[model samples]
Target: MKNTPIGRLRLIGLLEGISYLVLLFIAMPLKYFAGFPVAVSISGALHGLLFVLFCLAILHVMFVHRWSIFRGFWAFVSSLIPFGTFVLDKQLRREEA
Candidate 1:
């Protein structure tokens, strides 16, 4: 997985998506409901970094694979929604295979 560009990006995307879900369902709730802002701070920072890396990976894969602009755009958009990366990654795997 680490040796291939698309595989690396797919892994990163999955991690980023998991982090996003954690931030949304766990960290944010802990902050707002339990008066624990620290969780959000930590989760938010990690998610931000992961999100940036995922975006860069998307760009790299798009360029290297000569993917359409629309495909790249949708990949970026997919990261914004819950479980979106998993869906996009599945479709991408089919396309690649």
Candidate 2:
């Protein structure tokens, strides 16, 4: 899956999505409820990196595949919502196949 641009994008998207979830569900709670600011600090940093990578990967795939703006927009949007990337992955898998 790492061999192709779309595959790489899919992988990055999944990673980014998971990181976002961790930051929201686990890290934030740890910071506010448990008084563990470090959890948010670490998870936030990782999620930021992953989010950048995900955007770059999306650009790379868009250029490589010559995808339409709407498609790229959806790809970008998918990274924002919880479990959104998983739903996007289903469509991406169809394209890959």
Candidate 3:
């Protein structure tokens, strides 16, 4: 899990997805309801960084794994939806096998 490209990409996707959820459900609420803008500031930055990394991972996987354009697009789109990456990760695992 630690040594392969797909493993690295899976890890990145999970982190990025969790950060996105945290930013949306937790940090955003904290900013709006609790008047704590700092939560958004920090969480936003982390999510942004993770998202960029996820994009790069997709590109790497495209080259390394020879992913089709549609597959890569779904991976990109999945990152934008809640719990999408986890679902996509399962698909990816089946593909790996």
Candidate 4:
């Protein structure tokens, strides 16, 4: 891709969404139900990294897109909750399309 702000945001959104799904649906279950800790730790770390990237991407998008404080703040805040990035992705896609 061209690495435009929108592209970067979408990329982060994908990473964040997929990682979130994997960690929640697969890793967490394996850890808590199946007693596998290592995989969960690894997935958790990956999710954390993606989450940080997603947050930074959101901030970068805000400036590049010239979003108001309301949009920027909400988008950034949403990342803290599970599945929030996916919702943000929908919004971002709508804006782009």
**Number of clashes in every candidate structure?**
0, 0, 0, 0
Cα lDDT tens digits, model 4, 19-48, are 988998999999989999987899999989
lDDT of each: 0.91, 0.92, 0.90, 0.83
Q: lDDT per residue, candidate 1, 1-97, as tens digits? A: 4457788788899999999999999999999999999999999999999999999999999989988999999999999999999998898777666
Best by TM-score: 2
Expressed as tens digits, the lDDT of each residue in 1-97 for candidate 2 is: 6479999988998899899999999999999999999999999999999999999999998999999999999999999989999899889989988
Candidate 3 lDDT over residue span 1-97, tens digit each: 5557787788889999899999999999999999999999999999999999999999999999899999899999999999998997888777666
Candidate 1 vs candidate 3, lDDT winner: 1
In candidate 4, stretches whose alpha carbon ends up further than 4 angstroms from where it belongs are none
Q: Model 3: how far is 17 from its true place, Å?
A: 0.7
Location of the lowest summed lDDT over 10 successive residues in candidate 4: 1-10
lDDT, model 1, position 45: 98
Worst 10 residues of 1 by lDDT: 1-10
Q: Who wins the lDDT comparison?
A: 2
* RMSD of each candidate relative to the true structure: 1.1, 0.8, 1.1, 1.8
Off by over 4 Å in 1: none
Error of 3 at 65 (Å): 1.2
**Error of model 4, residue 77, in angstroms:** 3.3
Candidate 4, residue 57: how far the Cα is off, in Å: 0.5
Worst 10 residues of 3 by lDDT: 1-10
lDDT of 4 at 6: 76
